[model samples]
Target: MAIKHILKLLLQQKGISLLIILQVAITVMIVSNTAFISYATLQNWLIPSKLEENQILNVTTRVFDNNIDIASLIEQDVQAIEAVPGVIAASYASHELVLDSQGPGWTMFKDTQPETDYRVFGYFGLDEKGIDVLGLKVIAGRRFYPSEYIKGSFQSNNAGVIMISEELSEALFGNGSALGQTVYISRQRIPHRVVGVYQGKMLGESATYSQQQYHSGIVPEVLWGNRQKLNYLVRVAEGVPERVLQQVETALYHTPGRMVQRVEYAARAKKRLWDGRSTFAFTMSGISLIACIVTAMGIIALVSFSVSLRKKDHGVLRALGASRSMVMTTLIKENTILVFIGLVLGFPLAILLYYFLMNNVHVQSVVELPLLVAVALFTWLISTLAVYLPAREAAKVSPAQVTKSS
Candidate 1:
């Protein structure tokens, strides 16, 4: 009987009730999507680079003059960098260090012929010391032998040996061992032998959202060319990356034909690459918090307005043998029904919004049922609390007050 009365009261205030329902629906949609985005951002930011980030340094240099002996200059720079007090190992890096904004060169790799099954991978070129300089662990097989090292241009196919990450090994060879297997690079007719498989991460903007984040390969080649930028990876001893970074430019600046572009710790470069994601996570979190608070405030305002207008009705019920608790319970039940209806409408909107994000915005996380249920329960709780104070105030109205007002 009490619920029927509350339903009739709600029908009488259709305008205010509909407004509150719309507010709840919009809030649910925005909050749910923002929460998922924030979660995905944080997950991407936490992916490990699998390199000795703090103990390594990234140095970039460019040779503008075509007459300069690029190969000899690279060799000289590596030797000078290794002579630094804190330096452990240094190598000529054909590509920029991992986790940088610059994308690595990608190519197809296949284990067997008719080329039906193949996986795309990001490729990097480093010498025999590349594995140790980047702190990669050779889980299976062995590192490149000294004889395998060669000096070549970026586009040259002089490299005959390759090392792959564990992730790539699993992708290419499945459960079988990839050691000593001949794999073809790109469309080249030449087959390069896989010498080793290491565990490491070589992340870039293109691979950030894909399973290929760790699908990378390293070649035993010291790449240098006329009028091309040269990169080097330097590994320093513990507690001296900063000190080594300071001396790297001076060590590499032996002549004026080349320009030392920049020298920085690998850890700092990785952080710089991920700073955008971090900011995005924080921004979305703040928006979610504000949306929840605003929804709560909206519920409170609408429910309070309804109670004020129904005060005389509450007073009359109290006069006709209804207790204070009964009056409060009736008002609470009315708002509870409104909240339920709003949630029923809000759920569909939330799902539609999630799909829109997945398609257009490339949202990485899935729409979990538990998270949706939690949001619904949270909305219900907030609405119930918002109505509590207003219900209590209405329950205090006296029969004499209604009679006098009438």
Candidate 2:
């Protein structure tokens, strides 16, 4: 009977009921996207790529309109940077973090003769210790040695000189061991050997399990564009202040080279992904806020009209000895019940939106539970705030005017 009474009251105020439903639905959707973003960021941080947090920094020296001996300039710059007081190691690579990801390439392997391609495959032309300074641990065989840079030594040294991410290796060679598999990148015809397999992330950009994306392939001793590569990375020593990294930039300035620029993680990687995600959240939250406010106002307008139209009914109830508190309770309880129902429906709706984004977009990235909970809680809090004012207005009826009026 109470349920029927509530439904009849709600039906009489269709606009207010619809406003409550819209507010709940829109808030739930916005919160779900926020949850997915939080999960992706936390997942990226957890990767065990041993970053040389104590004694490294990344630098990129570009050869603008002119062509020059960038390799020698890089060597000199690295030498100078290493001379800084706190610096321990220095190396350069053609890739740093996930900024410029190399696309995928593949060949049938056994049937191909000289594996030279018309294009580049994966990350090529890393300096000595590019992997190590990034703190990659070789799970098998040996790391690349400096002597292998020579032409004759290239073929001889390549017989035992390649390492790869274990995940990439497994993808390429399947369940069998990848230690000796002669995977060929169609770069230079020289078949560089895969001497070692390494675990932990490569210095820059992580390649996910995409059959379409290429693994990091070796840049053989003979390649055309190897001369102009500008990829670099640095690991800061633990507790090193921001200005400490300035030493590396200053050190490079002393060396005769093209202009090298320090890559800021915040401006680069975090902006590329996290910042955009945050912006997306901010823009949506603003829109949701507007929608919520408009809906709450609509509810208030409709409830006010309902109270005015029912003045005589309120007067009779007051005449029958109903207290103002009892009349206010009946009115406020009607909207509160609707709000509760909306949230009940919205909880599952929010979960569904979160699932759609996580599975459809970042599904490959991974979904986190804690982030979802926090976001949902935040959404609920905001919804409560939106509904509170409208509920309060309904509670503040002027009983004297209603009871005394016809």
Candidate 3:
């Protein structure tokens, strides 16, 4: 049929077609955005933390008593934990895990020159063994020498030396080497020289929709004070039994002034984080499935009702030499026109929702024309399937049966 004829036929059922079009528009908008949200959530859950997640353990302790010198207590605890037989290396960290985003962050610039487009990265204070304990591989430059260690409980006023991850290096300097280069952190523009580049260091939560998570910078500082509670990262030797954690905990708690608040594997914490994201993804998937099903059912109902009302017309056309195939095609074409109209209305609605989410809610979403097109195609596919049975039933209508009833 020509486009104008199809439009005239659709105009005759303007009320029903408009209602179906609105239903389709709403369904497409919800489904496409939900699909994108689910995908982003799942990706974050699946990405590795870029740390020795399995072999590492976290031990957090705090000073329970006020008068106790926390610096001395932390030193004693570190010594005790390191003394455990299965421990390959141990180090203190001001942050529990870089993936948890529990530490400080700084906006860094490649050069000392001021610019507005600076990148943000996690800044952490770690001991010399922090890299080794976390199983981070120094791919370039060199680790901090003993003399470069920021000794004592309090960091000196000197500009600190630091190491960065390969991700941060690439972000700041691309493929070029970042070693021995200077970057300024914070508004003070404190200059820190990158001494080493390591792999598998994540600086923030994986779910964050920013590239800054991989840009981790480490400083060689003891970071122990009465006011500061440091977390211990212990690398257990291979073939170590589960009891090693208990032994390590006991060793740390053997000291008088401090208490071991928690001792657990890093994998547990990682699982906990991913669980939340997974739950969100599953919820979105459920909602998307429900929307598609409801939309399909609505389409089927509208097409079926239209077919019933046009039964006598199909009978008359068939009697006048319209073939069964032609009758089927007419019904299908009418519904297709409705779907096309819905797509025209739905695209803007989806874009408007995306804009509202991106601007007002600060959601992490990528607006892609192809993604929207794919969603429209899917909605049309479902609508076609729903209309097929109704269209087929209309084609089977007999002129004799309609004439006898009349």
TM-score of each: 0.79, 0.66, 0.84
What is the lDDT of every predicted structure here? 0.76, 0.54, 0.76
Q: Which stretches of candidate 1 lie over 4 Å from their true place?
A: 1-12, 44-48, 61-69, 101-122, 142-161, 171-173, 180-193, 202-208, 211-213, 221-228, 253-262, 321-333, 340-374
Q: What tens-digit string does per-residue lDDT give for candidate 1 at 67-168?
A: 877778778888999998989999887767765322333555574466447665667777778777888888999888888777765555556888888988
Best by TM-score: 3
Any runs in candidate 2 off by more than 4 Å, and if so which?
A: 42-49, 83-86, 103-125, 144-162, 166-178, 181-195, 206-229, 234-244, 254-257, 263-295, 311-333, 340-403
Summarize candidate 2's per-residue lDDT along 1-406 as a digit string, tens digits: 2667878978877876776766666665555555555455545545433434434555666555345555566667667766766555666655545444432332223214553322222444455655655666677777677766433212344433456666566666677776666655443343445677766343323242221233444432322144444656665556667675677667665444356565453234423534555555566557666755665565566666776676666666666676666676666667667666666777678677767865676432333566556655664455555445544554454557564563
RMSD score of candidate 2 (Å): 7.0
Stretches of model 3 off by over 4 angstroms after superposition: 62-64, 102-106, 111-115, 147-159, 186-190, 206-208, 211-213, 222-229, 253-262, 358-374, 404-406
Residue 206 lDDT (model 3): 30
Please give, for residues 130-207, the per-residue lDDT of candidate 3 as tens digits.
878877788999988888777565656643688888878898899898988988877778889998898846555532
Determine which window of 10 residues in candidate 2 has minimal summed lDDT: 203-212
TM-score of 1: 0.79
